[model samples]
Target: MRMQVDDLSDERVQALIMNHLESMALHSPPESRHALHFDGLRQPDVTFWSAWEGEELVGCGALKELGAAHGEIKSMKTDPRHVRKGVARQVLAHIIDVAKERGYTRLSLETGSMAAFAPARRLYESFGFTYCEPFAHYKHDPNSMFMTKEL
Candidate 1:
Protein backbone atom coordinates (compact mmCIF):
# COMPACT_ATOMS: atom_id res chain seq x y z
CA MET A 1 0.00 0.00 0.00
CA ARG A 2 1.08 3.56 -0.71
CA MET A 3 0.79 6.12 2.06
CA GLN A 4 0.12 9.58 0.70
CA VAL A 5 -0.16 12.96 2.38
CA ASP A 6 -3.36 14.30 0.91
CA ASP A 7 -4.83 17.75 1.01
CA LEU A 8 -8.45 17.87 2.10
CA SER A 9 -9.40 19.00 -1.38
CA ASP A 10 -8.79 15.57 -2.80
CA GLU A 11 -12.22 14.09 -3.54
CA ARG A 12 -11.19 10.52 -2.76
CA VAL A 13 -9.69 11.58 0.57
CA GLN A 14 -12.80 13.60 1.40
CA ALA A 15 -15.02 10.62 0.62
CA LEU A 16 -12.98 8.40 2.89
CA ILE A 17 -13.15 10.96 5.70
CA MET A 18 -16.90 11.28 5.34
CA ASN A 19 -17.26 7.52 5.47
CA HIS A 20 -15.04 7.40 8.54
CA LEU A 21 -17.15 10.01 10.29
CA GLU A 22 -20.33 8.15 9.44
CA SER A 23 -18.89 4.91 10.76
CA MET A 24 -17.84 6.60 13.98
CA ALA A 25 -21.30 8.05 14.47
CA LEU A 26 -22.85 4.64 13.95
CA HIS A 27 -20.63 2.91 16.53
CA SER A 28 -19.98 5.75 18.98
CA PRO A 29 -22.39 7.54 21.23
CA PRO A 30 -23.12 11.13 20.25
CA GLU A 31 -21.17 12.39 23.25
CA SER A 32 -18.14 10.29 22.35
CA ARG A 33 -18.11 11.12 18.68
CA HIS A 34 -14.95 13.13 18.22
CA ALA A 35 -14.32 12.54 14.56
CA LEU A 36 -13.94 15.82 12.73
CA HIS A 37 -16.12 17.06 9.93
CA PHE A 38 -14.62 17.78 6.54
CA ASP A 39 -14.10 21.46 7.27
CA GLY A 40 -12.44 20.66 10.56
CA LEU A 41 -9.92 18.34 8.97
CA ARG A 42 -8.97 21.15 6.58
CA GLN A 43 -7.74 23.28 9.44
CA PRO A 44 -4.21 24.58 9.19
CA ASP A 45 -3.15 22.71 12.31
CA VAL A 46 -4.10 19.31 10.97
CA THR A 47 -2.17 17.07 8.61
CA PHE A 48 -4.16 14.31 6.94
CA TRP A 49 -2.95 11.21 5.12
CA SER A 50 -4.54 8.50 3.04
CA ALA A 51 -3.35 4.96 2.32
CA TRP A 52 -3.98 3.52 -1.11
CA GLU A 53 -3.60 0.09 -2.66
CA GLY A 54 -3.40 0.73 -6.39
CA GLU A 55 -6.34 3.07 -6.97
CA GLU A 56 -8.31 1.97 -3.92
CA LEU A 57 -8.31 3.90 -0.70
CA VAL A 58 -7.43 1.48 2.08
CA GLY A 59 -7.30 3.72 5.16
CA CYS A 60 -6.59 7.19 6.47
CA GLY A 61 -5.53 9.08 9.61
CA ALA A 62 -4.68 12.58 10.76
CA LEU A 63 -2.61 14.42 13.34
CA LYS A 64 -3.55 17.79 14.78
CA GLU A 65 -1.19 20.06 16.65
CA LEU A 66 -2.63 20.89 20.03
CA GLY A 67 0.16 23.31 20.86
CA ALA A 68 3.87 23.69 20.39
CA ALA A 69 4.84 20.24 21.59
CA HIS A 70 1.66 18.22 21.77
CA GLY A 71 -0.38 16.61 19.02
CA GLU A 72 -3.62 14.66 18.77
CA ILE A 73 -4.43 11.65 16.65
CA LYS A 74 -7.59 12.05 14.62
CA SER A 75 -9.72 10.27 12.00
CA MET A 76 -8.05 6.86 12.01
CA LYS A 77 -10.14 4.44 9.99
CA THR A 78 -9.63 1.48 7.70
CA ASP A 79 -12.02 0.65 4.90
CA PRO A 80 -14.25 -2.06 6.31
CA ARG A 81 -13.39 -4.31 3.42
CA HIS A 82 -9.71 -3.95 4.29
CA VAL A 83 -9.82 -4.59 8.02
CA ARG A 84 -7.24 -7.02 9.51
CA LYS A 85 -5.00 -6.36 6.53
CA GLY A 86 -2.81 -3.92 8.52
CA VAL A 87 -4.18 -0.80 6.82
CA ALA A 88 -4.90 1.01 10.06
CA ARG A 89 -1.56 -0.01 11.48
CA GLN A 90 0.22 1.41 8.48
CA VAL A 91 -1.67 4.72 8.63
CA LEU A 92 -1.17 5.02 12.39
CA ALA A 93 2.55 4.29 12.15
CA HIS A 94 2.87 6.91 9.47
CA ILE A 95 1.05 9.48 11.57
CA ILE A 96 3.32 8.75 14.56
CA ASP A 97 6.44 9.06 12.45
CA VAL A 98 5.20 12.33 11.00
CA ALA A 99 4.45 13.71 14.47
CA LYS A 100 7.97 12.83 15.59
CA GLU A 101 9.42 14.42 12.49
CA ARG A 102 7.40 17.56 13.19
CA GLY A 103 9.01 17.76 16.65
CA TYR A 104 5.94 16.88 18.66
CA THR A 105 7.05 15.70 22.11
CA ARG A 106 3.83 13.90 22.88
CA LEU A 107 0.88 12.52 20.93
CA SER A 108 -2.55 12.04 22.43
CA LEU A 109 -5.91 10.68 21.28
CA GLU A 110 -9.53 10.37 22.35
CA THR A 111 -11.47 7.27 21.38
CA GLY A 112 -14.75 5.69 22.40
CA SER A 113 -14.95 3.62 25.59
CA MET A 114 -17.49 1.25 24.09
CA ALA A 115 -16.73 -2.39 23.30
CA ALA A 116 -16.91 -1.57 19.60
CA PHE A 117 -13.75 0.42 20.04
CA ALA A 118 -11.70 -2.39 21.53
CA PRO A 119 -9.68 -3.02 18.41
CA ALA A 120 -8.79 0.64 18.13
CA ARG A 121 -7.69 0.82 21.75
CA ARG A 122 -5.63 -2.32 21.27
CA LEU A 123 -3.95 -0.77 18.27
CA TYR A 124 -2.99 2.28 20.28
CA GLU A 125 -1.75 0.15 23.14
CA SER A 126 0.38 -1.87 20.81
CA PHE A 127 1.92 1.39 19.63
CA GLY A 128 2.81 2.21 23.29
CA PHE A 129 0.06 4.71 24.11
CA THR A 130 -1.24 4.56 27.67
CA TYR A 131 -4.40 5.80 29.31
CA CYS A 132 -4.38 9.42 30.44
CA GLU A 133 -6.56 12.25 31.67
CA PRO A 134 -8.09 14.35 28.97
CA PHE A 135 -5.74 16.72 27.21
CA ALA A 136 -6.50 19.80 25.13
CA HIS A 137 -9.97 21.29 25.69
CA TYR A 138 -11.59 17.97 26.49
CA LYS A 139 -13.12 17.54 29.91
CA HIS A 140 -13.97 14.33 31.72
CA ASP A 141 -16.33 12.18 29.70
CA PRO A 142 -17.49 8.68 30.58
CA ASN A 143 -17.92 7.80 26.95
CA SER A 144 -14.36 8.74 26.11
CA MET A 145 -11.02 7.05 26.65
CA PHE A 146 -7.92 9.19 26.41
CA MET A 147 -4.44 7.90 25.64
CA THR A 148 -1.05 9.44 25.06
CA LYS A 149 2.52 8.52 24.17
CA GLU A 150 5.75 10.44 24.54
CA LEU A 151 7.73 10.76 21.36
Candidate 2:
Protein backbone atom coordinates (compact mmCIF):
# COMPACT_ATOMS: atom_id res chain seq x y z
CA MET A 1 0.00 0.00 0.00
CA ARG A 2 1.10 3.58 -0.64
CA MET A 3 0.77 6.26 2.04
CA GLN A 4 0.43 9.94 1.38
CA VAL A 5 -0.41 13.13 3.20
CA ASP A 6 -4.18 13.44 3.08
CA ASP A 7 -6.16 16.60 2.71
CA LEU A 8 -9.37 14.81 3.92
CA SER A 9 -11.23 15.85 0.80
CA ASP A 10 -11.91 12.36 -0.48
CA GLU A 11 -15.30 10.80 0.19
CA ARG A 12 -13.68 7.50 1.09
CA VAL A 13 -11.49 9.18 3.68
CA GLN A 14 -14.49 11.07 5.08
CA ALA A 15 -16.51 7.88 5.34
CA LEU A 16 -13.63 6.15 7.09
CA ILE A 17 -13.40 9.01 9.52
CA MET A 18 -17.11 8.64 10.15
CA ASN A 19 -16.65 4.93 10.68
CA HIS A 20 -13.93 5.61 13.22
CA LEU A 21 -16.09 8.08 15.06
CA GLU A 22 -19.05 5.75 15.09
CA SER A 23 -16.94 2.86 16.34
CA MET A 24 -15.48 4.92 19.13
CA ALA A 25 -18.90 6.07 20.22
CA LEU A 26 -20.19 2.54 20.13
CA HIS A 27 -17.45 1.29 22.41
CA SER A 28 -16.95 4.23 24.74
CA PRO A 29 -19.06 6.75 26.58
CA PRO A 30 -19.42 10.30 25.35
CA GLU A 31 -17.00 11.79 27.86
CA SER A 32 -14.41 9.15 26.98
CA ARG A 33 -14.49 9.24 23.20
CA HIS A 34 -11.56 11.32 21.94
CA ALA A 35 -11.61 10.61 18.25
CA LEU A 36 -11.53 13.75 16.19
CA HIS A 37 -14.00 14.71 13.51
CA PHE A 38 -12.97 16.27 10.23
CA ASP A 39 -12.66 19.80 11.58
CA GLY A 40 -10.40 18.79 14.39
CA LEU A 41 -8.12 16.76 12.15
CA ARG A 42 -7.93 19.64 9.76
CA GLN A 43 -6.28 21.83 12.38
CA PRO A 44 -2.87 23.32 11.56
CA ASP A 45 -0.95 21.22 14.07
CA VAL A 46 -2.14 17.86 12.80
CA THR A 47 -0.56 16.03 9.87
CA PHE A 48 -2.89 13.32 8.54
CA TRP A 49 -2.07 10.45 6.19
CA SER A 50 -4.11 8.00 4.19
CA ALA A 51 -2.85 4.64 2.98
CA TRP A 52 -4.11 3.25 -0.30
CA GLU A 53 -3.82 0.03 -2.24
CA GLY A 54 -4.08 1.37 -5.78
CA GLU A 55 -7.62 2.76 -5.84
CA GLU A 56 -8.69 1.43 -2.44
CA LEU A 57 -8.13 3.29 0.80
CA VAL A 58 -6.68 0.91 3.33
CA GLY A 59 -6.44 3.17 6.40
CA CYS A 60 -5.43 6.50 7.89
CA GLY A 61 -3.73 8.03 10.93
CA ALA A 62 -2.50 11.41 12.10
CA LEU A 63 0.28 13.01 14.11
CA LYS A 64 -0.25 16.22 16.05
CA GLU A 65 2.61 18.47 17.08
CA LEU A 66 2.18 19.17 20.77
CA GLY A 67 5.34 21.14 21.40
CA ALA A 68 8.82 21.22 19.93
CA ALA A 69 9.86 17.87 21.34
CA HIS A 70 6.58 16.03 21.76
CA GLY A 71 3.90 14.79 19.44
CA GLU A 72 0.55 13.05 19.84
CA ILE A 73 -0.91 10.28 17.74
CA LYS A 74 -4.52 10.68 16.73
CA SER A 75 -7.22 9.32 14.45
CA MET A 76 -5.59 5.91 14.02
CA LYS A 77 -8.10 3.76 12.22
CA THR A 78 -7.82 1.02 9.64
CA ASP A 79 -10.75 0.43 7.33
CA PRO A 80 -12.74 -2.45 8.82
CA ARG A 81 -12.67 -4.27 5.53
CA HIS A 82 -8.87 -4.11 5.62
CA VAL A 83 -8.19 -5.10 9.19
CA ARG A 84 -5.42 -7.60 10.03
CA LYS A 85 -3.77 -6.75 6.72
CA GLY A 86 -0.96 -4.63 8.26
CA VAL A 87 -2.55 -1.37 7.23
CA ALA A 88 -2.54 0.12 10.73
CA ARG A 89 0.99 -1.03 11.34
CA GLN A 90 2.28 0.69 8.26
CA VAL A 91 0.37 3.88 8.99
CA LEU A 92 1.59 3.94 12.57
CA ALA A 93 5.18 3.25 11.52
CA HIS A 94 4.99 6.06 9.02
CA ILE A 95 3.66 8.41 11.70
CA ILE A 96 6.54 7.51 14.01
CA ASP A 97 9.08 8.07 11.28
CA VAL A 98 7.54 11.43 10.49
CA ALA A 99 7.59 12.40 14.16
CA LYS A 100 11.26 11.49 14.41
CA GLU A 101 12.00 13.42 11.24
CA ARG A 102 10.26 16.43 12.77
CA GLY A 103 12.64 16.19 15.76
CA TYR A 104 10.10 14.98 18.27
CA THR A 105 11.60 13.24 21.30
CA ARG A 106 8.36 11.69 22.49
CA LEU A 107 5.15 10.34 20.98
CA SER A 108 2.02 9.74 22.98
CA LEU A 109 -1.53 8.55 22.42
CA GLU A 110 -4.79 7.95 24.26
CA THR A 111 -7.27 5.18 23.67
CA GLY A 112 -10.21 3.52 25.35
CA SER A 113 -9.71 1.17 28.29
CA MET A 114 -12.52 -1.14 27.25
CA ALA A 115 -12.04 -4.68 26.02
CA ALA A 116 -12.82 -3.53 22.51
CA PHE A 117 -9.56 -1.66 22.55
CA ALA A 118 -7.35 -4.59 23.44
CA PRO A 119 -5.96 -5.03 19.96
CA ALA A 120 -5.08 -1.38 19.76
CA ARG A 121 -3.30 -1.47 23.09
CA ARG A 122 -1.39 -4.53 22.04
CA LEU A 123 -0.36 -2.88 18.82
CA TYR A 124 1.01 0.09 20.75
CA GLU A 125 2.79 -2.22 23.15
CA SER A 126 4.40 -4.04 20.26
CA PHE A 127 5.64 -0.67 19.05
CA GLY A 128 7.24 -0.03 22.49
CA PHE A 129 4.66 2.34 23.90
CA THR A 130 4.22 2.02 27.66
CA TYR A 131 1.35 2.97 29.89
CA CYS A 132 1.68 6.52 31.10
CA GLU A 133 -0.18 9.22 32.92
CA PRO A 134 -2.26 11.38 30.68
CA PHE A 135 -0.27 14.03 28.84
CA ALA A 136 -1.23 17.35 27.32
CA HIS A 137 -4.60 18.76 28.34
CA TYR A 138 -5.90 15.40 29.43
CA LYS A 139 -6.63 14.61 33.05
CA HIS A 140 -7.17 11.31 34.75
CA ASP A 141 -10.01 9.51 33.01
CA PRO A 142 -11.33 6.08 33.98
CA ASN A 143 -12.29 5.35 30.41
CA SER A 144 -9.04 6.41 28.87
CA MET A 145 -5.59 4.83 28.90
CA PHE A 146 -2.55 6.73 27.79
CA MET A 147 0.67 5.40 26.29
CA THR A 148 3.90 7.01 25.27
CA LYS A 149 7.18 6.13 23.56
CA GLU A 150 10.49 7.89 23.42
CA LEU A 151 11.72 8.65 19.97
Candidate 3:
Protein backbone atom coordinates (compact mmCIF):
# COMPACT_ATOMS: atom_id res chain seq x y z
CA MET A 1 0.00 0.00 0.00
CA ARG A 2 1.07 3.56 -0.75
CA MET A 3 0.64 6.23 1.89
CA GLN A 4 0.34 9.77 0.63
CA VAL A 5 -0.12 13.18 2.15
CA ASP A 6 -3.41 14.13 0.63
CA ASP A 7 -4.89 17.39 -0.48
CA LEU A 8 -8.35 17.59 1.09
CA SER A 9 -9.74 18.63 -2.28
CA ASP A 10 -8.86 15.31 -3.86
CA GLU A 11 -12.02 13.43 -4.77
CA ARG A 12 -10.84 9.99 -3.72
CA VAL A 13 -9.64 11.23 -0.35
CA GLN A 14 -12.90 13.03 0.28
CA ALA A 15 -14.83 9.89 -0.52
CA LEU A 16 -12.75 7.85 1.86
CA ILE A 17 -13.30 10.42 4.63
CA MET A 18 -17.03 10.39 4.02
CA ASN A 19 -17.08 6.64 4.24
CA HIS A 20 -15.18 6.78 7.52
CA LEU A 21 -17.51 9.32 9.05
CA GLU A 22 -20.57 7.32 8.07
CA SER A 23 -19.13 4.18 9.57
CA MET A 24 -18.33 5.99 12.81
CA ALA A 25 -21.83 7.35 13.09
CA LEU A 26 -23.26 3.91 12.59
CA HIS A 27 -21.22 2.32 15.34
CA SER A 28 -20.80 5.20 17.77
CA PRO A 29 -23.38 6.89 19.89
CA PRO A 30 -24.22 10.47 18.93
CA GLU A 31 -22.54 11.80 22.06
CA SER A 32 -19.41 9.74 21.44
CA ARG A 33 -19.12 10.46 17.76
CA HIS A 34 -15.98 12.53 17.38
CA ALA A 35 -15.21 11.85 13.77
CA LEU A 36 -14.93 15.04 11.79
CA HIS A 37 -17.09 15.91 8.86
CA PHE A 38 -15.54 16.89 5.55
CA ASP A 39 -15.33 20.62 6.26
CA GLY A 40 -13.84 20.01 9.68
CA LEU A 41 -11.11 17.80 8.25
CA ARG A 42 -10.15 20.62 5.87
CA GLN A 43 -9.40 22.97 8.74
CA PRO A 44 -6.04 24.72 8.86
CA ASP A 45 -4.77 22.82 11.89
CA VAL A 46 -5.29 19.38 10.41
CA THR A 47 -3.03 17.44 8.06
CA PHE A 48 -4.66 14.48 6.33
CA TRP A 49 -3.35 11.35 4.66
CA SER A 50 -4.75 8.50 2.62
CA ALA A 51 -3.53 4.99 1.97
CA TRP A 52 -4.02 3.43 -1.40
CA GLU A 53 -3.59 -0.02 -2.82
CA GLY A 54 -3.30 0.40 -6.54
CA GLU A 55 -6.10 2.83 -7.46
CA GLU A 56 -8.28 1.98 -4.44
CA LEU A 57 -8.37 3.81 -1.17
CA VAL A 58 -7.57 1.40 1.65
CA GLY A 59 -7.61 3.63 4.70
CA CYS A 60 -6.99 7.15 5.96
CA GLY A 61 -6.07 9.12 9.07
CA ALA A 62 -5.30 12.68 10.15
CA LEU A 63 -3.14 14.55 12.59
CA LYS A 64 -4.34 17.75 14.22
CA GLU A 65 -1.97 20.23 15.80
CA LEU A 66 -3.55 20.89 19.18
CA GLY A 67 -1.00 23.44 20.32
CA ALA A 68 2.72 23.75 20.84
CA ALA A 69 4.35 20.31 21.24
CA HIS A 70 1.09 18.31 21.12
CA GLY A 71 -0.72 16.56 18.29
CA GLU A 72 -4.11 14.83 18.17
CA ILE A 73 -4.97 11.81 16.08
CA LYS A 74 -8.21 11.95 14.12
CA SER A 75 -10.31 10.29 11.45
CA MET A 76 -8.53 6.94 11.60
CA LYS A 77 -10.48 4.35 9.67
CA THR A 78 -9.87 1.40 7.39
CA ASP A 79 -12.18 0.48 4.59
CA PRO A 80 -14.45 -2.21 6.06
CA ARG A 81 -13.52 -4.56 3.31
CA HIS A 82 -9.88 -4.09 4.26
CA VAL A 83 -10.15 -4.42 8.04
CA ARG A 84 -7.70 -6.87 9.67
CA LYS A 85 -5.43 -6.43 6.69
CA GLY A 86 -3.13 -4.04 8.59
CA VAL A 87 -4.39 -0.94 6.82
CA ALA A 88 -5.14 0.94 10.04
CA ARG A 89 -1.83 -0.08 11.56
CA GLN A 90 0.02 1.24 8.56
CA VAL A 91 -1.83 4.57 8.63
CA LEU A 92 -1.34 4.97 12.37
CA ALA A 93 2.39 4.20 12.24
CA HIS A 94 2.76 6.73 9.45
CA ILE A 95 0.90 9.36 11.45
CA ILE A 96 3.06 8.80 14.51
CA ASP A 97 6.21 9.05 12.43
CA VAL A 98 5.00 12.28 10.91
CA ALA A 99 4.19 13.66 14.36
CA LYS A 100 7.70 12.89 15.54
CA GLU A 101 9.19 14.42 12.42
CA ARG A 102 7.25 17.61 13.09
CA GLY A 103 8.77 17.85 16.58
CA TYR A 104 5.66 16.97 18.52
CA THR A 105 6.49 15.84 22.06
CA ARG A 106 3.21 14.00 22.62
CA LEU A 107 0.38 12.46 20.67
CA SER A 108 -3.14 12.08 22.04
CA LEU A 109 -6.46 10.72 20.84
CA GLU A 110 -10.10 10.39 21.88
CA THR A 111 -11.97 7.25 20.95
CA GLY A 112 -15.24 5.69 22.03
CA SER A 113 -15.26 3.68 25.24
CA MET A 114 -17.84 1.28 23.91
CA ALA A 115 -17.20 -2.36 23.17
CA ALA A 116 -17.38 -1.59 19.48
CA PHE A 117 -14.23 0.44 19.88
CA ALA A 118 -12.18 -2.35 21.47
CA PRO A 119 -10.05 -2.85 18.40
CA ALA A 120 -9.22 0.84 18.23
CA ARG A 121 -8.18 0.96 21.85
CA ARG A 122 -6.11 -2.17 21.36
CA LEU A 123 -4.34 -0.62 18.43
CA TYR A 124 -3.38 2.43 20.46
CA GLU A 125 -2.25 0.29 23.37
CA SER A 126 -0.01 -1.69 21.04
CA PHE A 127 1.60 1.60 20.04
CA GLY A 128 2.28 2.45 23.72
CA PHE A 129 -0.51 4.93 24.31
CA THR A 130 -1.99 4.83 27.78
CA TYR A 131 -5.28 6.07 29.21
CA CYS A 132 -5.27 9.71 30.19
CA GLU A 133 -7.54 12.61 31.00
CA PRO A 134 -9.00 14.70 28.26
CA PHE A 135 -6.36 16.95 26.69
CA ALA A 136 -8.06 19.47 24.48
CA HIS A 137 -11.48 21.06 24.43
CA TYR A 138 -12.82 17.72 25.51
CA LYS A 139 -14.35 17.41 28.94
CA HIS A 140 -15.01 14.38 31.16
CA ASP A 141 -17.38 11.99 29.49
CA PRO A 142 -17.98 8.33 30.18
CA ASN A 143 -18.51 7.74 26.51
CA SER A 144 -14.94 8.72 25.67
CA MET A 145 -11.59 7.15 26.37
CA PHE A 146 -8.60 9.44 26.13
CA MET A 147 -5.12 8.13 25.48
CA THR A 148 -1.75 9.76 25.17
CA LYS A 149 1.83 8.76 24.32
CA GLU A 150 5.02 10.69 24.77
CA LEU A 151 7.17 10.70 21.69
Candidate 4:
Protein backbone atom coordinates (compact mmCIF):
# COMPACT_ATOMS: atom_id res chain seq x y z
CA MET A 1 0.00 0.00 0.00
CA ARG A 2 1.07 3.58 -0.67
CA MET A 3 0.70 6.08 2.15
CA GLN A 4 0.34 9.70 1.20
CA VAL A 5 -0.32 12.91 3.10
CA ASP A 6 -3.95 13.76 2.52
CA ASP A 7 -5.63 17.10 2.08
CA LEU A 8 -8.99 15.58 3.14
CA SER A 9 -10.72 16.55 -0.11
CA ASP A 10 -10.88 13.17 -1.80
CA GLU A 11 -14.42 11.82 -1.87
CA ARG A 12 -13.11 8.37 -1.06
CA VAL A 13 -11.25 9.62 2.00
CA GLN A 14 -14.24 11.71 3.09
CA ALA A 15 -16.53 8.68 2.81
CA LEU A 16 -14.20 6.61 4.94
CA ILE A 17 -14.02 9.40 7.51
CA MET A 18 -17.81 9.49 7.65
CA ASN A 19 -17.92 5.73 8.06
CA HIS A 20 -15.38 5.94 10.85
CA LEU A 21 -17.42 8.63 12.63
CA GLU A 22 -20.60 6.63 12.24
CA SER A 23 -18.91 3.53 13.59
CA MET A 24 -17.68 5.53 16.55
CA ALA A 25 -21.20 6.75 17.23
CA LEU A 26 -22.60 3.23 16.96
CA HIS A 27 -20.01 1.78 19.31
CA SER A 28 -19.62 4.66 21.74
CA PRO A 29 -21.83 7.38 23.09
CA PRO A 30 -21.74 10.88 21.58
CA GLU A 31 -19.75 12.28 24.45
CA SER A 32 -17.30 9.41 24.24
CA ARG A 33 -16.71 9.50 20.50
CA HIS A 34 -13.48 11.32 19.86
CA ALA A 35 -13.02 10.60 16.18
CA LEU A 36 -12.40 13.73 14.17
CA HIS A 37 -14.45 14.86 11.21
CA PHE A 38 -13.13 16.16 7.88
CA ASP A 39 -12.74 19.73 9.12
CA GLY A 40 -11.15 18.62 12.34
CA LEU A 41 -8.39 16.77 10.56
CA ARG A 42 -7.42 19.90 8.67
CA GLN A 43 -6.00 21.66 11.68
CA PRO A 44 -2.45 22.94 11.50
CA ASP A 45 -1.33 20.55 14.20
CA VAL A 46 -2.80 17.49 12.51
CA THR A 47 -1.19 15.56 9.70
CA PHE A 48 -3.51 13.15 7.90
CA TRP A 49 -2.47 10.26 5.69
CA SER A 50 -4.33 7.89 3.42
CA ALA A 51 -3.17 4.44 2.32
CA TRP A 52 -3.92 3.32 -1.17
CA GLU A 53 -3.61 -0.02 -2.96
CA GLY A 54 -3.53 0.65 -6.67
CA GLU A 55 -6.28 3.18 -7.24
CA GLU A 56 -8.31 2.20 -4.17
CA LEU A 57 -8.10 3.74 -0.74
CA VAL A 58 -7.27 1.06 1.81
CA GLY A 59 -6.98 3.01 5.05
CA CYS A 60 -6.17 6.32 6.74
CA GLY A 61 -4.80 7.72 9.99
CA ALA A 62 -3.73 11.04 11.47
CA LEU A 63 -1.17 12.39 13.86
CA LYS A 64 -1.85 15.49 16.01
CA GLU A 65 0.97 17.41 17.54
CA LEU A 66 0.06 18.03 21.16
CA GLY A 67 3.31 19.63 22.19
CA ALA A 68 6.93 19.98 21.31
CA ALA A 69 7.67 16.48 22.55
CA HIS A 70 4.25 14.82 22.52
CA GLY A 71 1.89 13.67 19.81
CA GLU A 72 -1.48 11.94 19.59
CA ILE A 73 -2.84 9.40 17.17
CA LYS A 74 -6.27 10.07 15.76
CA SER A 75 -8.74 8.96 13.12
CA MET A 76 -7.35 5.52 12.31
CA LYS A 77 -9.63 3.41 10.18
CA THR A 78 -9.34 0.64 7.61
CA ASP A 79 -11.70 0.05 4.73
CA PRO A 80 -14.18 -2.64 5.72
CA ARG A 81 -13.26 -4.72 2.68
CA HIS A 82 -9.62 -4.48 3.68
CA VAL A 83 -9.90 -5.20 7.37
CA ARG A 84 -7.31 -7.65 8.80
CA LYS A 85 -5.15 -7.08 5.73
CA GLY A 86 -2.68 -4.97 7.75
CA VAL A 87 -3.94 -1.64 6.43
CA ALA A 88 -4.25 -0.13 9.89
CA ARG A 89 -0.93 -1.53 11.03
CA GLN A 90 0.91 0.03 8.13
CA VAL A 91 -0.74 3.40 8.62
CA LEU A 92 -0.07 3.33 12.35
CA ALA A 93 3.57 2.37 11.86
CA HIS A 94 3.97 5.21 9.43
CA ILE A 95 2.54 7.70 11.91
CA ILE A 96 4.83 6.44 14.65
CA ASP A 97 7.86 6.72 12.45
CA VAL A 98 6.91 10.29 11.55
CA ALA A 99 6.44 11.16 15.20
CA LYS A 100 9.88 9.86 16.07
CA GLU A 101 11.44 11.74 13.21
CA ARG A 102 9.75 14.93 14.45
CA GLY A 103 11.49 14.56 17.80
CA TYR A 104 8.41 13.57 19.70
CA THR A 105 9.34 11.73 22.87
CA ARG A 106 5.86 10.36 23.53
CA LEU A 107 2.84 9.32 21.52
CA SER A 108 -0.61 8.74 22.96
CA LEU A 109 -4.12 7.87 21.82
CA GLU A 110 -7.71 7.66 22.96
CA THR A 111 -9.93 4.80 21.89
CA GLY A 112 -13.25 3.42 22.96
CA SER A 113 -13.50 1.19 26.01
CA MET A 114 -16.21 -0.94 24.41
CA ALA A 115 -15.60 -4.51 23.31
CA ALA A 116 -15.91 -3.40 19.70
CA PHE A 117 -12.64 -1.55 20.13
CA ALA A 118 -10.68 -4.54 21.44
CA PRO A 119 -8.79 -5.08 18.22
CA ALA A 120 -7.70 -1.44 18.11
CA ARG A 121 -6.51 -1.51 21.70
CA ARG A 122 -4.66 -4.74 21.07
CA LEU A 123 -2.96 -3.18 18.09
CA TYR A 124 -1.73 -0.25 20.17
CA GLU A 125 -0.55 -2.64 22.87
CA SER A 126 1.39 -4.65 20.34
CA PHE A 127 3.18 -1.42 19.44
CA GLY A 128 4.25 -1.01 23.11
CA PHE A 129 1.57 1.48 24.19
CA THR A 130 0.36 1.05 27.76
CA TYR A 131 -2.70 2.26 29.63
CA CYS A 132 -2.32 5.79 30.90
CA GLU A 133 -4.28 8.73 32.24
CA PRO A 134 -5.74 11.09 29.73
CA PHE A 135 -3.29 13.40 28.04
CA ALA A 136 -3.99 16.70 26.33
CA HIS A 137 -7.48 18.08 26.92
CA TYR A 138 -9.10 14.73 27.66
CA LYS A 139 -10.41 13.84 31.06
CA HIS A 140 -11.50 10.78 32.98
CA ASP A 141 -14.32 8.92 31.30
CA PRO A 142 -15.59 5.37 31.61
CA ASN A 143 -16.23 5.11 27.88
CA SER A 144 -12.71 6.08 26.93
CA MET A 145 -9.46 4.13 27.14
CA PHE A 146 -6.23 6.09 27.00
CA MET A 147 -2.84 4.66 26.10
CA THR A 148 0.64 6.06 25.72
CA LYS A 149 4.11 5.05 24.56
CA GLU A 150 7.38 6.73 25.41
CA LEU A 151 9.67 7.16 22.45
Candidate closer to the true structure by lDDT (higher is better), 1 or 2: 2
Residue pairs with backbone atoms closer than 3 Å in model 3 (clashes)? none
Predictions: Cα RMSD each: 1.2, 0.5, 1.3, 0.5
> Which model is ahead, 1 or 4, in terms of TM-score?
4
Taking the tens digit of each residue's C-alpha lDDT, what string does model 2 give over 1-151? 8999999999999999999999998999999888888999999999999999999999999999999999999999999999999998999999999999999999999999999999999999999999999999998999999999999
Candidate 1 pairs with clashing backbones: none
Q: Relative to the unseen true structure, what is the C-alpha lDDT of residue 58 in candidate 2, on a scale of 0 to 100?
A: 92
Pairs in steric clash, model 4: none
TM-score of each: 0.94, 0.99, 0.94, 0.99
Please report the TM-score between candidate 1 and the true structure.
0.94
TM-score of 2: 0.99
**Which 10 consecutive residues of model 2 have the lowest summed lDDT?**
28-37
- Tens digits of lDDT, candidate 4, 12-85: 99999999999998999888888988888999999999999999999999999999999999999999999999
Model 3 Cα lDDT, one tens digit per residue, 1-151: 9998777687877777778778778777787788888778889999888899999989999999998799999999898889999999999999999999999999999998888899999999999999999988998888899999999
Error of 4 at 45 (Å): 0.4
C-alpha lDDT of residue 43 in model 3: 90
Cα misplacement distance, residue 135 of candidate 2 (Å): 0.4
